[model samples]
Target chain A: MLKVNEQTRQFQSGITIGELANKYKPAADLFILNGFPVAADAAVQDGDSCTLIQKDVIPTPDEIDSFLIARHTPGIQTKIKQSTIAILGLGGLGSAVAGAMAKIGIGKMLLSDYDVVEPSNLNRQHYFIDQIGMLKTDALKANLLRMNPSISLKIIRERLTESLLPGHFSNVDVLIECFDDPVMKAATLRSVLTEMKTVAYVGSSGMAGFGDNNKIHTKMERPGIYIVGDETSEARPGMGLMAPRVGIAAHHQANQALRIILGADKGRK
Target chain B: MNITLNGNNKSIQEISSVLDLLKSLELTPETVVVELNTTIIQPDSYDTTNIAEDDWVEIIRFVGGG
Candidate 1:
């Protein structure tokens, strides 16, 4: 058997790299066997692995960043770059999560938010002073594109509702629930969990105030359902959503989403 | 009747159905997930599923704010 791009293929006797490509992927111009570039005549043996590199295709600067990213993470980068995550709210958690995902090469992102960036949001959200009056979805999109030009983004400026979620999330791999209102959060979860059973759900709960950083952690609520936060913190008049704790929870959510995409949370569900 | 709601032990009158329990806690059924013992109860069955004494119930709702 030969491992090709992480998939096992039966090794045929008396076959060369050129012959195999001719039969399977006729457009292939380069073959890498066992971590070395091989010629058309190079022989493939059982238990060997192969990678096909497209001919005459040069990676742009953004694509180069993706290459380096995947190069560092080994097996995880491919899945990360193939994932499509829908962030329902582009507030503190959603903004931070989107930025982190873009940095790590998340292939596509769908951001939804109807609210404009407020002056108060600058303290904890990922927004600049000049973006105070702009829609959060637009601002976050601009920031994310600046970070990863290769990212495929779709933005919805309207308020998200159960009726609208299906059209936006029908093909998403993961859903990050980031609404700031308890009612909206509950509503989104209620609809999405029942409608889209296959999509992974990563959410945050009780991530308010400046308290022990250790309290922020990831919890697998059920199969395909993960929550990141203290699981008990609620924002009050005095106890607020600070940057430190909110960022911690957002990182937990982002990390969990990545792990889910990479199948790292497979059996641990 | 006693039940464990969200990992917390609580004593309440026999709430009759899952819908009753949600209403007693001031929660809207559409926005909450109810787990009885270890099985998840469907949202439509909230009014039909009964809550027994000593039942372990998890009333989970989303926390707004990131």
Candidate 2:
């Protein structure tokens, strides 16, 4: 028999459950709900007997990069350092994906792209005038470094052919499918599945006059591999992909990646 | 036939190859991917892949937002 409220106090003393999360929003995030250590808003059951918890959001990739290179790189764990990620394209989705990864402090990244900045890209991509006509991999690498100077970056300014991919991609922990081509995305999906057993995340939509990129639905293919902004699989969209739409897809991809790394996404997908 | 995506069906098309169908719908390869009968067909192969009658083809595109 389980005894709840053993150390029970008064008034504010209540057990955590799926319903109570709304009230104790702060502590609700840290409680282990549904058998995983997650935020307080996670669910629980009556008489489950759990403890309250609290957590702090970490700094963005830019800050972590500076810190690691200047101070903490040596101390970070090998499991984390050994974790490698591949970002297929460097357009709207890839740019956002890179920013998210850098902020979350992924140990290493394989940023690959075979495009250059154009005037049209300026309207949506995370690139500036000086970067126009410059290689996307170069520009992204510069920005990524600014985000986290210490990250072990292995950038490939080439298309992700099977040969080029076999080396850098084989040992990666996760692969972010942010490529722009439908063929590339399709070919890429098959490529990742064939190469390593690494968890892969892909961006599916977002490319139009002016679309919102933060609201797309992301799905997990493997328990860990996920695809964000899937316009069809989720029965969500049936329109032309636009800028913000792809951005939303990228955001979902990023959110899931972070959730998985922290062990918070367990069964929550 | 009735269908929904994100939830809406702006236009309808009745055609053969996905490329032709999309062109008839005025959709471009740069903006979307064709989901024919739950299978995703790459834009490069849109010319060769045929869309069967009554096939549920989902054309998805990118829209901008934060």
Q: Each model's C-alpha lDDT?
A: 0.81, 0.59
Q: Write the per-residue lDDT of candidate 1 for residues A29-118, one digit (tens) a residue.
A: 889988999898999888887776677765465545645464546467667777899998888899999999988878899999999999
Candidate 1 runs further than 4 Å off: A1-63, A70-74, A267-269, B2-11, B23-31, B36-56
Model 2, range B1-66, lDDT digits (tens) per residue?
Answer: 333332355344444677877787676565555567767675578899876545676655542222
DockQ of each: 0.38, 0.08
Model 1 lDDT at residue A184: 68
State the displacement of the C-alpha of residue A29, model 1, in Å, after optimal TM-score superposition.
33
lDDT of 1 by residue, B1-66 (tens): 988888888887765799988888887776566779877777779899999988999877755567
What DockQ would candidate 1 receive versus the native complex? 0.38
Candidate with the greatest DockQ versus the true structure? 1
Residue A62 in model 2: lDDT? 52
